[model samples]
Target chain A: MAGIVEFEKHPADTLKVGKGFSLAKADPDATPGYSGNKADGEALLADLDGKLTALQEMLFAESRFGGRKRILLVLQAMDTAGKGGIVNHVMATMDPQGVQFKAFKAPTEEEKSYDFLWRIEKAVPAAGMVGIFDRSHYEDVLIHKVHNWVTPEELKRRYRAINEFERRQTDAGTTVIKVMLNISKDEQKARLLARLDDPAKHWKYSGGDLKERAFWQDYMDAYQAAFDETSKDHAPWYVVPANKKWYARIAVQQLVLAALSDLRLEWPKAEFDVPIERELVERS
Target chain B: MAGIVEFEKHPADTLKVGKGFSLAKADPDATPGYSGNKADGEALLADLDGKLTALQEMLFAESRFGGRKRILLVLQAMDTAGKGGIVNHVMATMDPQGVQFKAFKAPTEEEKSYDFLWRIEKAVPAAGMVGIFDRSHYEDVLIHKVHNWVTPEELKRRYRAINEFERRQTDAGTTVIKVMLNISKDEQKARLLARLDDPAKHWKYSGGDLKERAFWQDYMDAYQAAFDETSKDHAPWYVVPANKKWYARIAVQQLVLAALSDLRLEWPKAEFDVPIERELVERS
Candidate 1:
């Protein structure tokens, strides 16, 4: 636990305070701290860019290789858990075309009419696409389980269903990475309070968000259960400590790189059939 | 034209030929040389990651405000004209929570039953969200105009309809940005050839693409007409010279920064009371 917050740096004075909310800060000296490593992360980010550029060249070379391979990343967490920060840094070095993102909100009436996974399934990446789901079907487990919308038996079924769904995708060559950005209860409260005080972040807060905060313990239990049930070999879940945004991002990027490395991509060879005549054009 | 390809290094040597297709190079120095400025482009790409980071903070801050603003980015171009490259760089730095993207292909049977704009309307970003269209209703102008699927009269009507639709969005506080990535005919030929040489890229190439290639002049005429009619103050089109990927990416990012800066977003103040004091458990 001390390692969770130690690796990432948060400006001690950056905390914001407002009418009803207080920003949370991770106790740096805590046992599980944020030790995922910044230098390593920066290096990895650059590496990911180089790898992707190479992959694009290979993918471009084949031309018919279908489309770009789409990677869907799903990050789910409680309020102030650093999901936004994680998204920013992990995608910091990636080419925009290869990545597509969606943030799931409380289902609209039309969305509710369908199965919980319906809107999300539609957001899945095409053959050569990457889809990032800020919050996903795991909501069924996290919220519904906490609020008792579903019974234990039904919730148990969802866990297995999620596992099967992910397995099928991995088998079909779609990399599904699920990250649970876990933050401490105290830190979450602090972050929420900061949101209320900062004018720029005020729009992200709501009066009702407090209601969810009240059930912090309930959410933790649900998340633990979800993890226990769905952490399969094909689709593994990484428990990312969110108290430190840098570590969370680094961990997620590493996961993405590891998953993409499995594809064994290479640059396609160029065929110069028409007899190349190289003419140099100079710019004055 | 010299400004467009000035710093543009032709990567024809980087073109890979695979099993099914051939790779060719475009002479950027040829007549009507590319029109993008490389120095300006480099400066733009260099600042994109940082600018995007600031924009997301501004967006998050703005969301707290009661009023909502939506940004819809429409991308239209010929195949292999760097649409993917443009999308990749422009939106690369945004917070995934506030940004959403959709790529439209040939309409499905269900989609075909509705007016062409129906599916497109469904894709518009809600308040405080940024929506990106890889290929949009402009297809009705580009493809339909060239293929005669719609009469000249119908095509003319769509221009007005699209204009009004965008104006309505603008009136609703949505900022609309339209980008037309302009690649010369010679560039298209090179890309098509590259696709044939690489086995992996073969999936992206189809024999029918060449059929469209044969009528390059007609497509150009159609595109020029579409640009002339649809370009408006509410949703102006940026004719991006895409012979150079780096230049194209920079141009798009600059355009995005310009649009978002116009919003004048600021971080919201937090409102919580009673400071929650937390201790540093560890320090680096």
Candidate 2:
């Protein structure tokens, strides 16, 4: 309540990809629906962070008591786009028990043996849990499309498979929320250099980041194409401008709050005779 | 700073097991080593919780740069002793990425097939991570011992095996800290009744809890025996008084901080050429 926000443009609308959405049209630095400065965004996030704990507990409680609903947040971004930041600041707000977090790296030999979706399916959130994927099934297309590892026909097939796979998840009571942390080329350059500039941050940097930056436009085009192919009414993608870290954090936190709020969860009614159990406990 | 305490006795010294330890000597109502009232205990937890995030990140950063050290906090307690609360408040202070939490329920048919340590071996903390076991391999002995599911000879064998398993963990750079949350019969009775009294908390109650409570004395005996058998130089056990929830949280958090601080982790040094990456990034 201390950092109450009445959004000039609600992220649910401004960030959602509509028909004919294009990567060329999105401005990486614009705070799309927010009328807040960095300080205001931080305050908004602080106010909202504590709200997640109770909702998460309700979800976990429901899961134990026959509730099938769960939440999945898929994070996709290029290097230095602050994907890890989202996981640290946003997803970690929930009790770790209620959060199932998996950061997908390159496929290992065992993973390569199966279809890409094989691992992704295994990582889906169970009833009443929130699952966060740092990089996900989207990699099979995003990276592969950039590298041309998959044939055009195969790429198209994989896209269709992904949509079907997500549909199955939703049908099984998982709400999929995908987020793309959008950073401009200049912002990324600044971030990568900032990491290199500091001794403590070296572990987060890799020489290959520069190589990937060269394919920036190609990756963006791949993302635009993937959104066009797979973004749906059930599982929509939201693009959060990440040039300002504070704004991106608040935006994603709002998206999470929106999805959980939609569940209309209530404290479940007691299934047993309260008097009987209390009497039994008192006697013990 | 707000909740700083000059300890009458540090938990490290007061709560640790000695040669002839018994659970009966641990007063669940006593706030050992902490001279604070409930309000003071709450302040201590708030001040201490913020300290974990930086420590956790340094450990994670170290792990990425080939540091082999990690921390493992094993939690053992009776029903309603607040194991779930510890995980939510204490362990959740760190990044979920750095914390691997597993709450052991009834072992499955598959688990029963393998040796008891089989499932546990797979869940040990990797380098630079902190692993918390809400209930651990001790259950294999505690419950099985209480139910007479194993012979005295088999129980002795399992105890030695657990010690050996933990030694291997420590030898491989894991600082294994085991804690048992001590609570009284009276307190557990109150907790069960409170759960039954509230509709929101009814989900946390189970009919089987009464059956388990009937074996309270037997379970306590089993715990004492297990501690005497398995407490070692490599993996010592600590008994924390849990009649006061705030005291338990701060005690466990202090144990966590002591374990991590003992490692003396510093921010990692830069592994790449700053000038080169800066030039390349600039040109891009």
Candidate 3:
């Protein structure tokens, strides 16, 4: 909500989470910032690929030569909301060298032994990396709240911890982009059915998914509560509509583009005497 | 190598390290399995992207559904030899979620305290991932041998340790691909000059690059000796002719395609009751 004016020139502003915003009021089918159709969205994504890839390379190069700026893109969404599609289509062109991706799952017994942030802290992108998290620390506030996995007081405490945790990331020069791939229950039903129909995609479906879907409204309430509690100036949550897969991909790509472009990345300057090195390389 | 005949249908065989292979004999300009010009190579690479990406996705999907198979593609070469290029162009299409890349540099104080393979072991990709090492344990043998950084006996021990390490990986359902992007000294010189000439690329240029180029023959000997000692049936090193950037990219892509295809991947079956899940999802 605070970033609406900050992102005024970008599509990100259209999806910005304003204070007291309700998920029910937003249309998952709405294109928001874009007036484009599916083909247009795809074409624009393709056009943005070059600038995105270049900026990513520059960011990576900056880290290698002694710079401390990185990007952490945290994606939160219902199942079949196309988080994976955003990664495959929007970020597939990036040099894997500069990309770090982790999809968090149910915590293991060992993970349960430590603070929830312990595993997350280890996965933070180092300088110059674009770290993509499929599901992240917000899960503690979202699902943990929805499922009553923790005490209500403990769940409330997690919100404060998440906000502070993200503030620290900003302190350490990590630009955090938190996104909720907003999709409707109907859209989820259709997608789940599509998965059920396709043998090739059956591996992605599970009985647990429906159990979660049964709590759809509760989950929506959970997401809104989490957003209200943790969304901040440095790492505000932007709810990109997910019903139209093409639009979701393009919007997320544009958000990343704006974040990187804001950094105004430059190729790191040579750390050696260029003239001397040039001569030496010439003789060799 | 032991894998030469095994890789005969692919370009990998043409570049394979046989029992008594000599680095001096291999021409960097030769396009072994391919007879095409640069344009044809580019066309083939474009054509191969679909299959490569599909295979990577299938491999990732398989891992998520109880499959344990994975790949470790170890890239070793001198400076400006196109290791990064191969990753950027060849792996650019695959989902970043499935890739884990590390560019091994000179070890730090903590890393140097452990066995050379400790950091390497940590970086090995988990189930269903493609782990790429820009430079790897082979550095302990190749560069260490070139610079006499380790005692000859200790350096020789590392070869044995590396062989056993790769064997253990294969024993654990990991397929290892070792590729030495073989670029001629002249090609290296030209590339270094090109980097020096372009301000944008200057960050990649290093004064140390010249110091390393001075020991070109030593590096060649180091590479040959290491290959002779450690290239095994499970992971024989492929000596790719890398002067033609297009040829190297295409050859490496084909090699990865061959490796993933060898696994005979299929879409994993639903782990839950499909009928029950479908019924629940529909009602929801």
Candidate 4:
């Protein structure tokens, strides 16, 4: 509640994609949220931590008290664009009991047998949870389009399906916060090179990453098309400028806090006799 | 690795249910794994945090590098018996990306239409991940038995199905760590009363919790039967004493660390020519 006042005008308002939004025109390095240096951004993020923690706790408490609402944070980004960092730094602040984190890797043999959203549907946060999808159902549209894995007609059908699926989730008391960590190619190259230079980070580097980088232009086009098609009001896509890790982290944290605060959650009332319970405890 | 050496004789080995094991004989207040005070246990848990984090990172890295094995932690406990505490305190130390936490609630209309494990099968952690079931497939047997929701024959069938399902997971490279947080009735009453006394915690308290408490002995008998029927070498269940929150948290952490260490995980070797990649990075 304390930090909530400062975030009345969220950076996400500018970053959120609307009709006919051009990904080509969006600057990946733009810090639209908080204009500050690295140190200042870090301090702001540290301050937001307590507010986010309290909000998540209340959300969980509300769910337990028969409140039916939950939140789903769908994060779609290119490789090395800091999805892992967001999960580790931003989500790690909340009580793990209330946070469900799912990283959608390439479809497994069994998963491939079902529809793409089948695995996703199973991972949707239950009531009283905040679900984070590192990479999600959008991958089917993004990579599949880039690689020509699906016919264009099939891709269009999948897009419609995605919209309906998300619509259903929102109708059923789920707030969908979809984010795309938009990082420039140069930034990605730098991040990849850093991983290569550090032996400890070698485990995270894969030969396939370079292969994907070769098709970066195609992937970008795919992302642009997917965003244009699937950016609905209920599940609007916010393109977070991820070149600056601190700014990106703070922006996403603020977006989440703002979404939760919008819910107007409060602690549920005790239905039983509190005085009698307190007396019982004292007597015991 | 330092703590791994100390855990050669895991306390879970003693707490584990063997053939003809009786839950009635188990003391829920006993701290078997640790022989220390709360402060000492907290210190020990802090030390294990780094080791657990390291091991989990290796496991995740290995999975990305094509390691097929995973870890599944099945936690089953009564209300107010500290399941949420175990998830928040013990499991929260791991990287969120590498850990999947699923808390099973009462079956939905659709979920009830399928076999109990149908929904659970969808939530098993993928390779290189740690899957924690806050409550799990075991619930069908535990609660259904207490409430007579299933016929005796159906209960027998469900027990068999659970064994076969877990066996399949193990065959597919998942190590199952099942635990029952054993808490005394008095401890549970005290916890419930604490929730009632605190306005902030009122949301977590429900009248149904009291109704369930009235059937405490029946629930205990149901759990005992479940343990006798489902406890196997591949998916053994450890009963962690839950009266002292610190001890329960530490004990579960030790059990998980020991299970992971047994896998002998390591940082995966890079497939590409590292020198060449390093050269390319420098040039770029």
Candidate 2: residue B215 Cα off by (Å): 1.5
What residue runs in model 2 are displaced by over 4 Å at the alpha carbon? A1-3, B1-3, B6-8
Give model 2's TM-score for chain A to 2 decimal places: 0.97
**Chain B of model 1: TM-score?**
0.80
Residue range B1-284, candidate 2, lDDT tens digits = 45466457778778888798878988988888878887887777777777788888899999888999999999999899998889887787687778888878898999989999999988898898999998999998898999999999999899999989999999999999999999999999989988886777888888989988999999999999988998897788999999888889888888888888989999888766789878989999
Per-residue alpha-carbon lDDT of model 1 for B183-282, expressed as tens digits?
Answer: 7777777777676655556555555666677677788788667766776767777666577776667656666766778888766554543232112111
- Report the lDDT tens digits of candidate 3 across residue range A79-186: 999998998999878988889888899998999899999999989999999999999998888888888899988987788888889999999988999999999999
TM-score for chain B of each model, two decimals: 0.80, 0.96, 0.95, 0.96
How high is each candidate's TM-score? Answer: 0.74, 0.96, 0.95, 0.81
Top lDDT prediction, candidate number: 2
Residue A9 shift from truth in candidate 2, angstroms: 3.4
For residues A1-284, could you state the per-residue lDDT of candidate 1 as single tens digits? Answer: 12222224321111111122211232322313334456655554555566655554443333334434546778888887877776676654455555566778889999989877778778786665566788899998899999999988988888887887777677776777777776787677677667655555655666566778778878877876777677666666656666766556656665666556666665443333322311110100
| Model 1, runs deviating above 4 Å | A1-37, A52-72, A92-100, A110-115, A118-120, A160-175, A189-198, A206-214, A264-284, B1-40, B60-65, B187-209, B244-246, B268-284
Q: What share of the true interface contacts does each candidate keep?
A: 0.38, 0.72, 0.89, 0.55
Cα lDDT for residue A30, model 1?
33
Q: Pick by TM-score: which candidate is best?
A: 2
**Judged by TM-score relative to the true structure, which candidate is superior, 2 or 4?**
2
What TM-score does model 1 achieve against the real structure? 0.74
